[model samples]
Target: MPQITMSAPMSKFSSFNVHDDFVYKNVDGVAIKTAILVPKSLKPGKKAPVLVHMHGGGFMTGNRLFEPWFALWFMQWAESVGAVIVSPDHRLLPESSSEDMADDIVDFWSWVHTDLSAEVSRVTSGATQVDLENIAVGGESAGQYSFRAQLSITNHEIGGFLSVLSALTCPNAKIKAVVCQYGPLDYEVPWFTQPNHQRSIMGAPPAEPGKPEAVIQDYLTRYVDVEKIAVRTESRVEELWPLCVAYAHAGKLAEALGRSDKVMPMRLIEKAESLPPIWFVHGSGDTIVNPDCTMNFVNKVKKLLPQTPMHVSMEPGEHGFDGGVPLDEKWVQDGLSQTAAMSSKPGEQFEVRQTSTTEDYTPDPSKSLPLSPERQALVDDILALYSCQPTIRRVERYTADCVYDDQFVYANDRYKMAGQWFALPKFFKESKNERYEIIKNDRDLIQFKNEQSWTFKLIPKTATINAIVSLSLDPDTVDSDFIQVKYHKDQANDKDYSHNGFGFQFKKFQADNVVKLMSSDEVKYFEKDKHAAKEPVKKYGTGDETGQAPKQDF
Candidate 1:
């Protein structure tokens, strides 16, 4: 556990400017440290939204300045959205209680609100920046507990010991959003399976063997002192306990008594009706804090505050999504590639096209062709293209006919239906002979669907395509679908590329026809004649007629 020492100020992106080692003091008069990052190009006179972030360390160890990735990712996001990020380091445990930890957070907020108001005001006034109304708080692991405590103080639920400082310091404080990443919400659950029973059998703290009944008696007698114990014993007549001498030991008695009903009891704090939106991210494979803890807490919170927007992302990694399993550089690379592909410059679009030689042309509505070896190979290749690794599951797939489907299964799993397009790659290496014609084109549309799905529409000379994909278990069946492939292509230009793309709707029991097409030219040709009268192309586009090439997925 090396202490965090700030070396040099670094910038993550061009827009994000960071300052390291910003120190602030807590109410206890401890000099706590923090890292502050601000977006450089903000409009003058506007209060920008700010995010206060806490790092995860199981409540025992961690520093804001040391783990720069947490601040870096947050600052990058803030800069992208023109917001500010503040990350603070709180005092660690053994020296601090949960109460003291909560107090430290409130103190940090107080300093930001009052002591640093001039800096905030300068940043906001000099540039039309910062939406003061839209402040957010977030943390990972033990830090999440602190953030939760902050929310509890805001809701007036069992007022945190630090609430007084918060009221005096940041009376106008209002958090718009909260994000918790793999945090422990409950403490009472024992270190072993049967905590309570084990405690009783183990005979309390400073626990030693052969000291059961003696420990209990000494604990009870010390509250009234030795004289009272002797008087009671004399009246009872017969027995004089040999282990009674330990009763006079105040430290032992205190430790024994402290282990009584107070240690790690399950407690719930009632939330306000207008609680802020919450975002939770955890790993399903997390062995440390069970993912159920997050869902359970969310359920309880929603029961009290139904309107609070809650979102959860259970990634493939283990606890903290960093440790345990060996890190997969390919997964990291793929994520980076996807992120880069999603972010396109203004007026630029990326395009992809896929073609196959074995169409065996079938346009007849009622005809069904027997599977040939080549056709079967084509089908296998296409299916193989959609397959994912054990780590990567297919959560959803959408077809062109506005129908969603996920019928494919591997390793006792099936996918769900999503309306947006997404892509999920298999972890296993593809065979040399296996091939699937897949043309996925992506462009940043003005508006996008929240869920994974597929969309296709014909423009005057082009067709708009969109899809959403994700990795999630099937809601109906608890089957694993870790990968999602969403394909959307913009076909506004009547360009002739010898490619064929087919879409299908699949179910657990039956396969349904969605849309199967050979080329965009054929799609356009079908739209031309009244005699043809094919399915009318849906009217959906960003309304910007400028033809931008679709993004190609590599």
Candidate 2:
């Protein structure tokens, strides 16, 4: 067992008292350090739930305090929700594999259950003040992956990717829930295998095996013996070669990598049938670990355990929702509130502050004249129609416009248009014309130049004359070629728009098309539907003798 060390001294906050220490003599004889965060104020004879949290960093980097932001926020939540949090500093990569990390957690759980039986009883009995049955496990990134391994063992699966099989199979049946933040579920998925796994295994191209420039070989040489490095290199060929072949043949190498037979079988999910309920938090714009990972797992779980409670929150941002990212505070609170609600007993009280507000304001006629009754009614009608729609208005720039001459427009090989967009002009200017910036802030100026003026037509289905025609520009100068579009729809529009009655109608058209490109899926749907020609006629009910329907219009 590895020895435990606490570098930072424990500090007491208003809501919680944080203590850092090591848990020695782990099950695998590896000593690991852990941190315990206990809520400071608790009512006498009242026990709080326990949450075991793991941090992210792809399982390779990260410590018990890997993400201090989440730690602080979670501590605040624990105080408000009355929960106890335990975060352990597990063994990391290069020194250990993900299995080793999972084993460390299992060992810690055992120690908490058996070795510290007195403390456990004290906490549960409200002497030390911690709830026993309401235990939950959670983590972010690689920590999340390891947490899944723990869940897998609790559900009983043997021998696959990592060596934690022996440790995981011993059921710690007390755990109530599991939460993952942007964790990778399917290791065999192409998104996880190809490019990513390959790069991690063999390093990048132009740095071949046994060569001085080979990064993979260098990394291996630093970590393992020559014999082990040779074995790992050979193993890479055995694992990734078939994956590459599948990718070439199916155009779905990512999905292929995720297939159960390729790496870790998808049957693991089935084995996890009796597992506790799960909560998944992912960023909508996450590219590192595709949101598809969560979507696929959730879909499979829903089929296997329809009654198992699962809540997924898609934040309007990208991976690493800790700091410096646009995270939804409301979404986080809602998730915490849900967790608290689920953990509480029948009559137990759990209070979460809801900050959503509705405004009631009177229009000022002095600043702007009030509209006529008829105009006001028209405005009301428009608002009523769009009230259910999810509208997002943000400034974005037109980075490229591909247009061809009349003769070349019909030519198969004729160039259409393709260009890059950036988030800031300062980056473009700093890059010295190598790249152009798109939209960073609303205050930033946009530049648009006509590389070739082309006619564009956009017709709405509801109204034939509701068409938009604009002169699209092409890339001429790096910094001087940008146009601002006030509104852009994210991929979730279909899901959000479903409430507005338009989402289901447009759902089929949203597939395989980037939000910016319309001619692909957009044109295909347009050609099939032909707008108003397929519109359903509105039916009106007969009115009563009083000249109104039995159900009067509000």
Candidate 3:
């Protein structure tokens, strides 16, 4: 067992008190830390539900404390929902393997149940207690793996093959609900096995026996070992049997790596009946993790546990969409509220609710329209100059014209600007400074605002702007290139944006093919009657990403 220590609440914010310190570790003395948010409104004798959230970093890097905006975002959420939020620090790769990280989570969570519950008085001084009956665990990206491992290992402890075969009784690690945001539930899927994804999470690749890159070699060795086990699954190879088999084998590998269970979640589906309700939130435009990953997991879980209460929110934005702007602040609050609400009851199930929101970049180009190639080229040229690049990547071209309506608000003033190519420079000049500086320009969004704040006026003034871009196949007569811009000014002489804020959705367009509802009743019926008669939709990707064998990228 690893040592456990916790610090006192760091801040005296009105709604919650924040605390940070190491929670648990392995025999190797590698300690994992936690940032806890405890609501102040709780009665001294009563207990509060616990939410153990893991941060997103593709399993390679990330921490409990994020950037300024996200930090405030988490704190405000804890304050708003009035729950005990525990964000544990999982060790990153190179220094720790996936197995080791998962072990840390299990150990940390176990310690929370036994040790922390006993010593709750030490941290809270008996003012608050941790409701041991209700515990919700969740994360984003790599963090989601932590939840899977925590649940899997805990499930195994309660009564999986080893426990049942050995006739051992393990204490139940109570979990009330789960919240997963933009995470992959299936690692064996080809999307993750690719060189790029592998490099990001498993480290630079080309793993072989006795390779110089020891980390990559170890990861590959473990992965190969799991693959071999997956091939031996007794059930149909294409079904969930293979996925569960691979995870079971991963549990063996985890032990070899000095841990408890694998960082895979497919096996957990089999135990859905024993698990709590789940909530999933994802961005449709997330390419890094792919929305399909979440969609697939949700679909599988639904098929396995159809009557299980589940909630999903698919919004239009890139990764980390819930943060970064004011409009999204509501989305974050909704997610947090859902988590708190779900955790309120330990045994009851809720109905499944699927909700989604899209920005100006509608898939239906006929409504918003596109610009001609020549016109788009000119817009791209302007953006290239602003981005300080010679030319924009053609592969990153945008086809939809900008949607400039009442979506933009600056210091209480609401104005609509048309023609994104032309509105951009004009909006730049609206700043207190005569000229605006373009900080970042990418295919997804563009960031620009005032530049003279650093010079220091008698009363300093500044602003930061972000514009989410929209692309179409080819623009013919579209006049505007602007989509939606969230502009904020520190001293803009207006009340609406005296602080920082964001906005979107000037005009609503029906979801295009890519982001349309897949699990809807009509779609499912259509698939069952029309599509099921036909062949399965062929999945495709460039190069070896076509779900074939691993492409050796040594």
Q: Estimate each model's TM-score.
A: 0.40, 0.45, 0.43
Better of 1 and 3 by TM-score: 3
Better candidate by lDDT, 1 or 2:
2
Ranking by lDDT: 3, 2, 1
Per residue, candidate 1 scores C-alpha lDDT tens digits across 1-554 of 00011222343435555665556773344467776667776544435567676654434334563332252344434543456777776654324445455556666777777645456555445553445555666663221112222220001011111221222233356665565666544322232122122231112233244354455455456633454322110111011111221221212322321222222112223523344445565667654445665666667666765755455666874554532111123332222222222221111011123222322221231332344342333233333333421111112121111122222310111121210111222122221222222222122111111111222222223222222221221111111111122222322122212222222112222221111222233222212111111132222232122222233321
Error of 2 at 2 (Å): 41
Residue range 1-554, candidate 2, lDDT tens digits: 00111122242245566666646444444356666666666544445567776654433334555333243344444554456677665554434444454555567677666644355444445355555666767764221212322211010010112211211233563766666666566444556554432232111232233333243334446765344421110111122232232232332333422343213324565665454556677767654456776677778778986766566888775555433221124455445434433332211011011111212112222333244342233223222212221111111121111111111111000011110111112112221111111211112212111011112233222211110111122111111212222111211010111112343324322321222243443123222111111112111222122222122110
lDDT values for all models = 0.35, 0.36, 0.39
The weakest ten consecutive residues by lDDT in model 1 span: 152-161
The local distance difference test score of model 2 is: 0.36
Shift of residue 250 alpha carbon in model 3, Å: 22
Point out where model 3 deviates above 4 Å.
1-16, 40-43, 67-74, 140-171, 196-261, 325-554
Q: Is candidate 1 or candidate 3 better by lDDT?
A: 3
